[model samples]
Target chain A: MIDYRGLQALAMVIEHGGFERAARHLFITQSAVSQRVKHLEALIGQPVLMRTTPPKATAMGQRLHSHWQQVRLLEAGLGIASTPNQLTVRLTVNADSLATWLPEALVLPDHPNVSFDLLVEDQAVGLRRMRQGEVMACLCASAEPVNGGRVAFLGYLRYRAVASPEFIANYGLKDLSRLPDAPCLVFNRDDPLQHEFLATVVGGTPQRIHYCPSSEGFVEATRVGLGYGMIPELQFRDLLASGELVDVVPGYALSTPLYWHYWQTESDVMLNLRTQVIKIAKQRLLAEA
Target chain B: MIDYRGLQALAMVIEHGGFERAARHLFITQSAVSQRVKHLEALIGQPVLMRTTPPKATAMGQRLHSHWQQVRLLEAGLGIASTPNQLTVRLTVNADSLATWLPEALVLPDHPNVSFDLLVEDQAVGLRRMRQGEVMACLCASAEPVNGGRVAFLGYLRYRAVASPEFIANYGLKDLSRLPDAPCLVFNRDDPLQHEFLATVVGGTPQRIHYCPSSEGFVEATRVGLGYGMIPELQFRDLLASGELVDVVPGYALSTPLYWHYWQTESDVMLNLRTQVIKIAKQRLLAEA
Candidate 1:
């Protein structure tokens, strides 16, 4: 069996790009770094580093390092010595969602016993991590439920084709076809949801777009007439109500289904969470679904 | 604001039974239950119960009950005394991911000040709660990237269309299109990713699907020839390698893009998680744009 400490030392070496630097980072001797890497390679029966000017982690090293990191996080959560009923609940979520509804869900005072650990990520990655056991729950796009879990369909979150009136006045998008060529604001290149919707309408990905990675920035960009992008219905609703945002596509918007999925494994805490979420979805989101 | 005691009383009533039963559950008189309910109703500006036979909760009462449940779960995590580090992290994640990758990200021994509380849930719902601030992080769907944070585009998770040899021989799905309407094992009705992929290839959604809500059951079902479903590449790779399973769609499996998102707010803990996740993603996941 490989010693975890040896593997950890080697990882630090690779991260620092050299044994000498790694020694400084870990407050150990440079020779120790070299020794650990050598020991790890001997145990794995594979070379874990390249003996180059700036040392690089071999494929084996990278894989092991990745695995080691996961072990570390798990240990941290478990390390919390429980005092009586002090159980920690770790959650993964997206930032915008954190800013919006999570606060509403965690109305304290009533829940005196529970404390939280928040892991924020985008919807896509959050699900992947959740599946990996990095987090306990997530709000994700795949309406398809997870196995060993109950599916609480939170319904589709609508996206309005929004733009500031000033922008609309400048570039009158008379039809959906014109959107591809228009200067559009996008969350990022990876955000193909808007493109997917546009493809459904225009038959292909849009050619003209600018990347705004910030959620607030994306909305603000649209408001300032950077271009028309699909803004979440909830955020745009008030803006639309205030006449700040005009729907480029009136009476039509793209919506992606959202689902709340959780493990079916019976834990009083987890069971309660699932039930509460389902109830809330039934009240707030099921109608939309 | 409403008194938490009233909510607690309502919870007891709901959990126990009618006012009389609730009184027994709380070890209080029936009249107290009646009074507490009335007080709660007045506080929320809505009636919570019928006050009649069997005493059903009203619509607003249901909402309150759900809220109370979330509080209970959060309270469970917190225990009694409030900790100085109340910026708790809560997560809902799948077990496989937790088993394989998540722990490595959260528990780096070096980061001592940072702590986590974990809740395991299905990937989909984790995101929903994250959006609601019920959790700070989640593993979810949607590669489009969220704002107020950076998106670390972790590579796509590939799922192979595998089946046990027995299943392939019995169903003869060499050409997936030729297979008769065999019951395709699925996590739940909401899980349409695989179905959507099939729809794209088969030209429509299949009419017959066997739902397996348990992850283990889903995997076992596919292995035992109950049906074929797309299984995660990591878990099923060995099965395919050993020739225990056959790939229905060789070289045609689906790969879902994953991303890591978190608050850009100057939070040491969130930043640590974000950095760790990105590093791991680059190494383990298919690191692409």
Candidate 2:
């Protein structure tokens, strides 16, 4: 059997980006870390790591690293931690979800031993992080799952084209045909929501555009008349009711279906998270088939 | 003199990723786009674009692209547009400022002709986007400017360690030394604020850590007892005042100095942005030398 310590060394080396830093992190000497990796290579009868500046993992190394993570999670799930009940689960999530209903689902019970490491990514390509083994799961727009993973539909996130009253008056937004002449807001170049909305409603692109990437800041920018663009229902519903934001194209809304993708695991923390996310997401997002 | 239309074609090819898309966008034939790029190469006396699958800009090509962008901006400033008045400026900005104060500065005067494209980036590495020629400016934490760029000191963004009352009570967070035993939140793996804050206070790292990348969501996560984390003064000052959040460590705060870095330009839009950002950031941020 391969020593678990060797796998730990391999994981640390990749995580820290170098043997020297891994050694410092592991509280071991640099040569010992190298020897363990060498021993791992010998046992596997193939090179697991590429010997480069700040060395990278080969396919074999990545597989072993993934195996090590799964094992660690299982151990933690079964209360077999050597470090006294400590686990860190890494994942990627979209900004719209993070700004809206995801936090309620995140507020788990008092087993604070299980920690989280989250990176913000666009929902369209979030699953790539999981495929790269950078994270164990991703909350994204696509319902497609990665290899050895499962997917759950999280319902649709509806977006409405909105602008402030002052903005509407100043830009003469009442004429639907001249909508393309007014300034508009987009999250970024990669975000196609504004284009998608325009394609559905006006069939012409806006001449003026402002990109504000923060989900909350997007609302604020629109409120202050930087431009008009699609705002998620979860974020803009209250604002619309309060008359802070008025739909630029009334009676029409764009809906994007969202999905939660996670590697199939027996870990209690992951299972609980999956359950919580599914339950809360169903309750919050627009219910759909 | 080199044909400006050929330079426009070259820029479109690099921007749209291929000749076909560039042709479609330019309302010209695919072969015509190719011929224009070929014409540019002949004028330069060497290859400007690498004939790769997605056609990358060589150093010469990148220089020409930057030159074209500058000339376009100059023309916009001088009102020489073929499509009347239209200008789009792209830049990268950090999230904290976006959530707190940047949007007001973004709401420019009635020229609505001056549009914006902003991408969210961590302050430490945001200048890389500008250096890559993807953006004309970057709002970042570093005072050091990029090559041929100008930087203005925007004062410091102060951060204080904070937690919910329930979290503090549940985790016994009063004792300063036992802080690392409690779960802590960070922006992401690349963020060093928690480590730096801990080093200053306890000199021990937290075994339980949560990383939430959104500046707004980070606060929400902390408020909902996901874990204690450092919150920016601009975001949390009201929460602190209203008793929604309490200081984990009183009488001490970490302050990150912010700077505005912009490519040296005579374009009115960029200059106005620089002026407005500096004026507001100085007012919002802590006065620091």
Candidate 3:
């Protein structure tokens, strides 16, 4: 059996990103922390931590982290109250959901003892993080599950093409010919949504664009007349209802289908989170078309 | 002499992430787009794009993009009415500044023709993006100039350790003994400020942490009792003043010194931006000690 002491030392080292800091956390000497990890490596005949500036976990080290995380989850499931409600659920979620309805799921009492380690990533990028063995669950665009993980269709996170009233007036965006000259907003360089949406409706991309990486800031930028792009349903629903946001295409909305990918475990925390997130997603997002 | 058509085709393909979409924007066939990029590669004796699934710019491609961007900026600076007031200024900024005083810079009338391409990255990583030939000016923490790029001190972006009322009450965080049990919040995996701040103030990291990457969402998560985190001055100043956020460590604030690194150019647009941003930074951020 793997030593819990060494596993913990490895966990602290990787999580905190160094041995000295991990030593402080584990209430052990820096050399002791190193020795514990080294001993584990000797036993396994594989290096766990790479000796980078801030030491990084190797693939073996990542698996070890994943294993330790699962052990913690199982401990929580079995009511092993050694630490009295101190279990961090590491989850990676897309920014849009966090800005919208995921907060409801977080506050729900199903996992009262559990806190969270919410890593906000874009959907296209989040799956690799899961594969890296860092997170317990990922709210991702990928329908395929991670190594032995399970995936459930949450629903299509509906987005509508929107711009502020001033933006529309400034560019005369009602005319498709003028659309090429108008400043557009995209989340980042990787976001194909704006260009793809434009390609479908207007036959091209905007000649000029502003890439605002923040979800809330995207809305604020749009409101203040920086540019226009796809805004999520709940985020724009109130704005569109109050006429704060005008439709770019007038009748077009895009729905990005999402999936909840989680570890295939009977651990109560994982199961509870899986159920709660799916339930909230169903309520918040549009039904899959 | 290099061809503008081929350069534009390369830019469109990289920006939009595909050849087909790029062709749609350029009003050329997909084959024409591919051929233009190929011809440029043949001229340079190096591949511009990696031809990956979503084709990525190689090092040569990125430098070409950078040269193209500087040319665009220079064109605007020269009042060359070639594109009729259309230039996108690509910049990577730390999110806190964006949340606070950077928007003021955006609205200012320094570069009337320039739109923005703002990529939000943490200070630790923004430097690499600037080096990757993605951005012309980078608002970063790096004091070092990038490949003869001009660097100026923009003063310190101050952050204070803060938590909502209920979190302090729940964790009894006033006592340093109870601090380890407190659930803290950090921006993301690469963010060391929270733990580093805690280590200095209380001599250890919090046992648990939540990673909220969004500048706006960080404040919202803290407000909604997700977890306590270090918040920026303009973001948490009102909350702390109103007693909505309580200081985790009273009388202590962490100031992160920031620098603006811009492309070395005599272009009026570049010069104007440097002046405006520096002026705004001095007004908004804390003076370096």
Interface RMSD of 2: 2.0
lDDT of 3 by residue, B1-289 (tens): 8877889899888867799988977788999999999999999999999989789999889888877887887877666566663566788888788767776566534454677778787665678777776788888787888786879898988788888898788778768677766767788777778878888877876777766777777777777667788888777777888888888888888888888887766477777777878888889888963
| Whole-model alpha-carbon lDDT for candidate 3 | 0.79
lDDT of 2 by residue, B1-289 (tens): 7678889898878766689978977889999999999998998898889988779989889878767776777776675557354555677888878887788788778455776767778765588767777677888888888888889888898888998989898888888888888888887756788889898898987666777888888888888888889878878877888888999988878998888888876587788778888888877888862
TM-score of B-chain for each predicted structure, in order? 0.64, 0.83, 0.91
State which candidate, 1 or 3, has the greater lDDT. 3
Model 2 chain B poorest 10 in a row by lDDT? B79-88
Provide DockQ values for all models, in the order shown. 0.01, 0.64, 0.44
First chain TM-score for all predictions: 0.64, 0.82, 0.89
* Candidate 2 lDDT for residue B278: 82
Q: Which CAPRI category fits model 3? A: acceptable
lDDT of 1 by residue, B178-249 (tens): 543554655553466667667766765443455444443445556655567877666566677788778776
Candidate 3 has a DockQ of 0.44
Instruction: Name the TM-score of candidate 3.
Output: 0.85
Clashes of 2: 0
lDDT of 3 at B130: 76
